[model samples]
Target: MTRSATTPRPDAAPETAKTVSTGLIIVVLAFCGTLVSLQQTLVLPLLPDFPNILNTSSENASWLVTITLLTGAVGTPIVSRLADMFGKRLMLVVCLVSVIIGSALGSISDSLMLVIVARGLTGIGTSLVPVGISIMRDHLPSDRVGSGVALMSATLGIGGAVGMPLAGVIYQNFDWQALFLVSGGFAVVMLVLVMLVVPESTVKTKGRFDYTGAVLLSIALTCFLLAVSKAGTWGFMDRKTVSLLVIAALVLCAWVPLQLRQGQPLVDIRTSLRRTVLLTNTASVLIGLAMFANFLTSAQQVQMPAETGYGFGLSVIETGLVMLPSGILMVAMSPVAAWLIRVHGPRIVLIGGAVVMALGFVLRAFLHGSVLEVMVASGITSLGTALAFAAMPTLIMRSVPITETASANGLNTLVRALGTSSASAMVAAIFAAMSMDGMPAVPRWEAYQLVFWIGAAASLIGALIAAFIARPQTIAEALRVPGEVVATERHEVKRPEAENEVVVGGVVTDERDRPIKQAVVTVLQTDGRHVDWGRTDNAGRYTLALPSAGRYLVVVSADGWGPMSGLEDLGDADLDQIRMNRRLLLTGHITDHGDPLPQVMLSLIRHSGEYVATTHADTEGGYEIGLPPPGRYVLTVVDHPTGRTRSRAVQIGSTSATLDLDIVTGIPRPRRQPTEDVPVR
Candidate 1:
């Protein structure tokens, strides 16, 4: 088979080469991410000056920022899907080039329309963040994945926070065009670095690009966000705003079923709806709104005049300086965020982040009397933002297939933009409507405080939502080349409508309450002879048919797990009546000629010496198995190629048991004798 330039050849790199290359790859990708984010904050300090410079009304000049938001929201999923289809590094290069061209255009443009178009082009690069993440996952070693992802995610906050102060200083000293020129220069440097260092993704989803879905989604997002962003200027009830809302709603209603029918959809609505992915994305939206609330309000708060009684009366440069600590905090805390994800699941990290963010806003609401106070509060929230941002992508990656990681991550980023737009509109409306007669045309201090409280509420809601997210069923997905399935999805076995089978059912879970996926629960006669059997779903729920209801033993086995056996009286019952306690625990290891052999398949053999259930040994050749009833059974190693077999006669008890195998010659194949009990074929 021929290989492409982007696909990493398994035999090409030594372990040392991969170790050295992975570090440079992470740095280059993160730098590119940082540069892309600089654009998000680069326009903030220039917004007020743009109207006069470009000879446009303030409303039209606002498009300089609005256009970017609109385009970024629409570009994320499209660029992500493209990356998966073609290659991640290839698409990232395209994104960086777009940013360079956009920045260069804005630097030279004198027309307001030209500048807005330039900003829109720059927004297309926002897809870089998610695609970069997909690239890292595809390339990084398993142990390094958490840190690399954390650093990449933190670039958003770092760029936004650091860019503000840097933008302020540049604006104070140089021409307005210098801002775009500097950004353009940064993009160029990053483009070069990415081309030199980042490897192309080997995980490709080969399919026709969903052009129709792309267009439909872009229209829906653009209309929906435009309506939200303009709701403050145009009355909420204005015909334009209402019309956009109607069009967006109608488009989405039709888009859902269309995507469901397509063979290669731009977005997988089914995967997105998985409990883990759905809740995490929902929390992402709320957290984005909460994070944006800080961006929307804090800088303005410090720049407000002191006479307002709550304003800090700081200059634009000083305002950025004050918020600078939080940006640094974001980058600094990345390792900590990564560590938390490695030790605890992303769900726990997400909950902690949401609560921390809520507390930061609560502090801002009551304690905005001093810049020091505000800065400290901002730092707290930034820490939370760092944690949440890092954890969100990990959750998305764990839940999505390798083929769709980029696309799924892209959809998540788009949802986050929705939150940011909502925050802009919500904060704008609050401050505008609550204002009384005032100098500097600002609202009452209470209005600013109220926005913080609303932000706090959003964070709390995010925390609540995150608490309910379930962990992924199987082992977290690992990055693999295209066509390698990392994890198997648990789907229920459909039963016939009018079946007369006596059904027994229960849920199997590990010690941590996570479902033990791919477990086989066997229903055997009272003497460890199989009668009927079924496998557990990804959720670890299983149902088996009982040939007759007198007495039976159930055994459970999963890959890397030891066998579990228990006794239960079906007692002539239906599905609801069978509630076997699936709590047996057994552990063991497989070795060949005294050397541990991982990935060996083991079968749970019956007392009849028949293979009934199967499992695989893990990386260390260790396995854990849970069983239903404690009984004597023969565990066999079904070595296919060698055809050498080993068996261990083991008895399970109320507690856990261990049975190790050396597989030397064979364990004499367990002295089998013919049984009178009917053998399950």
Candidate 2:
């Protein structure tokens, strides 16, 4: 009976069941996400009431919202790293609970300080959306993962859009406390749903927590975000802002060296440095800025009075009602974005999204008056944002290892948040700089035009980056390779077989005669030119097609086996078969007598008169070279960093073949002690 080739082990049935469970979890999480997004806009209508209620200036009241943004910027990356280390489910619960407690507190509080604290608490939950998307990825099936991610990403826009109308209705009819009460109630429901539906997801990572790294990262992010978020209020040139930015720079500079030394790092800094990851993250920042600019500019424009030179004069509720179409459009577009990703691939989808976003901005530059015009601009821009957001996580997921998906995606989200924070500061600056009359001047319709032009420019830059940065081929491309080339004609090359044509075939075995699979057989010519080749089916038996062979060096190698080599004459008649004696042990001690050198890679190169075979030592500095036939072999060991090599000749099989050396001390040690018999493979 013909045996089957190796197939990938099927995923556990329970895992499949859990994947289905992710949909419900995402829905619940999205509901909670809605509450978090609602907080961003819920206070917009109440902006006018803040000064009266708190008896504070407008600028002071603004801190209620600003503080939350600042906290969110600080909290996202920290929470993301913790999720990578601990458990995603646990972090989700913690985030939701923070939102619930904050909402409840803000609903009951009369003081502005209490409300600001409540907002900060809610900010913790707001940062969880990216984390939640990442968690869903761990459980969901590949087929379902994209749509699930897109839907979750859409909540970033949906929650904000829906929150506005909801908040407007509550603020107009009931007290401002009602807004917080509704948010708290929604969060409570989400919390319960999450507990019931969300499965536990924790990536296994080895090593102790990098407390120092986390603290430094947090301090740096806080300082950087604070400076960006408050740039308009604290002038860009202000010493306080400049000082904070410098401190942030210093913290980031110090973080790199510390991370490299740690075995288990909080962030995969080296992996994130890849072109695909780094560039995608950079583009995400620009896209985020553009997305937020849409929110800030359109929200303010829609609510301004018709009598004001550039205002449309719609009530808060009417403004939200008019903007409702854009939210609906975003919801409608998400699945389409998911479909585009599946059809064209993520790189194409990302590039297309950037182009579309830029086009939307260009259109907005011309059309910025009626409620309909603003709605159209919002809808168009949101469609592009949805496409880009959906593609980004997919890109990050594909570029990274399965283990680092959540962490990488989390970092991407953090970068995007930086962009949004910067946009907030930039918008404030634009408004501040464009004053016309005695009163705070409304931006002429032309100001919105200038903002859109800037947005278009940023989007174009993102498009160029995505086109250049992504890998040329993906996993799917690799899978399709067999059919990619078509055979037109066959060409054959013939060469004379040597007098001693050794038909070498043998079962590659371990110390025990167990078959080794995929062991490589190398035939080294006397000249430097040599042909190295492989294949021992499930039963490790390899055959080499000789090329004008004379006395050639033959070598055999597998992972656990000690590498073996021998000199053989491939004479004229194909020498029927040679059963390789799996003996000859090459072993050694790898220790830094003073300090442990954990990252050392030990390689063994055969330097016999005419034979050569190479293999590396395992993590423990122990190495084994395997061979089919035994002969004289010279062993050469090299240290990885210094490139210093040591060599010694040893006879194999003719006498008991056992070789040993101490790598750290660069000293030749005996294969066997004077009394102890050397262990043979």
Candidate 3:
């Protein structure tokens, strides 16, 4: 059966390993995700001492944090795309190795520059969260996917909450190298568990990696993130910050149009444009900004000197302990959030979560009588963040194709990171400007209150946006599975005959060179045996495995476009891009007893009784309907005014044609010959 042009081609059958324990896989993946999150905060307690320890300026020592943010921002999309193209498990393992290497190097080195390099390498592991989530979607049963995603996402909060206290305890007992040692050790264990428990995903999109797109996106993200992160220190209007922001904006302006035209884009911008996805991502940014304010200020509130009138003067360890309950609340709320999502849908959950977060932030803005009060309010926000974060991946996965889960989730993760970066900048700026009057002034109580109020506002705005987000229209859309293997059943050649097939791939485009998505490219052996067939992805690229790299017939077709076929010698070389010039359509006139039947309805159906398209005759009796791939079809015309109807069989070939139908006798009338190219009044 031919694939429908208007719908996504059926996915390949899911490939799962029955021996792998799903529970064990979730444990390993969530643990790894938590480890990655821990890396972000592990050095927070050490940041104050880093300058003296490494004999470097405080500004230079900050690169340890800044570099990772840069690398993680740049790496998330690229690594996620590679995961979709390569095996998810393979990328998972690669990411784990990078973490292990970076951690080990940092554990042994004291040089600021070397540790920054190590941290940059470790940052690559941040992408493993999305890839792991994709693996859960591929392997977990439909009933368990929500919970698995919640657990994975909750790790972001879990590790941040745990990292500071854990770092404090370790720093007081041993040297700072111990922290890296612990992270590297956990990575090694997680890597082994991943290989043993997590099954490799079978779904992969076939295309050449879009290196140019990747490079451009990296430059853009790096510049933008740098500007936002450094704006507090450099001044918002400083030339350096402004130049970076300008460069980032200019690069994005060029990058978007290029991605739209690319045969294989690193990020699927078209899917991102869908209402559900677009709004969820927007809400993600706001929710992220609001949620991070709790993390940023909760411990600081506890550590403030008692003389500040709203201070507790707690030790670093004590402050970390005080704030740890918020992370615990996040974890405890995961199953609750998942249950909410399963019942009311992700959109409702997101909105509810945002509302909850907004209320929590408002409470934080006013309820700081003691550490206990601050902890309770922070925990409430964390609970809401658990719901919001959990719902985002579900919304994204449901809206995007199964093959693109990693990259789509990666983009969402990237946006959330953007929100957090902005939050960091805003918090720093607010604190710096609102300092109390003293030699070494501290931020006044009002600064913290202002941040909380801003968080509340961001949360409410996110909730408002979530209210407008569209939900998936069907249950099947929410639960996409790799259905059937188009590769195995569709191939005409015997499986044993093509043991050593080589992969050939290219893009499909129209006459105007616009990429045509959902087009099918079929490869056949010279003697009429079909080696393999593939469908174009969102970027209009397709791939086929040809037997033994010899000569083969390549056939490309789409529903409304003319079919094209040619023989080409297939090898390791890239196939030439295929272009289809004719957008076949059946245009004709409807008549009744030799008179025109204007404003009549027409339907095009296939010979096998499948619906193709519908159109209506214009005032001049002319009607046009797009034709499907070359086939026998029946065109029916109905005149509503006279209650007359007619049906005629049509044979569409590789070109456009015209016909005229006689409704009175149910017979087709001959088409009129073309008139001369002369002006008519």
- Model 3 off-target regions past 4 Å? 1-18, 439-441, 472-681
Model 1, C-alpha of 305: deviation from truth (Å) = 0.5
lDDT of 2 by residue, 319-392 (tens): 77876777677767878887776666677788888888888888787777677877887778888888998889
Worst lDDT 10-window in candidate 2: 479-488
Better of 2 and 3 by TM-score: 3
**Better by lDDT, candidate 3 or 2:** 3
Q: Candidate 3: which pairs clash?
A: none
Residue 611's lDDT in candidate 3? 92
Query: Ten-residue segment with the worst summed lDDT in candidate 1?
Result: 492-501
A best-first ranking of the candidates according to their lDDT comes to: 3, 1, 2
| Model 3 lDDT per residue over 355-454, tens place | 9998898898888888888888888888889999999998888667556788999999999999999999999899999998872348999999999999
TM-score of each: 0.70, 0.69, 0.74
Local lDDT at 531 for model 2: 34
lDDT of 2 at 670: 52
lDDT of each: 0.75, 0.67, 0.79
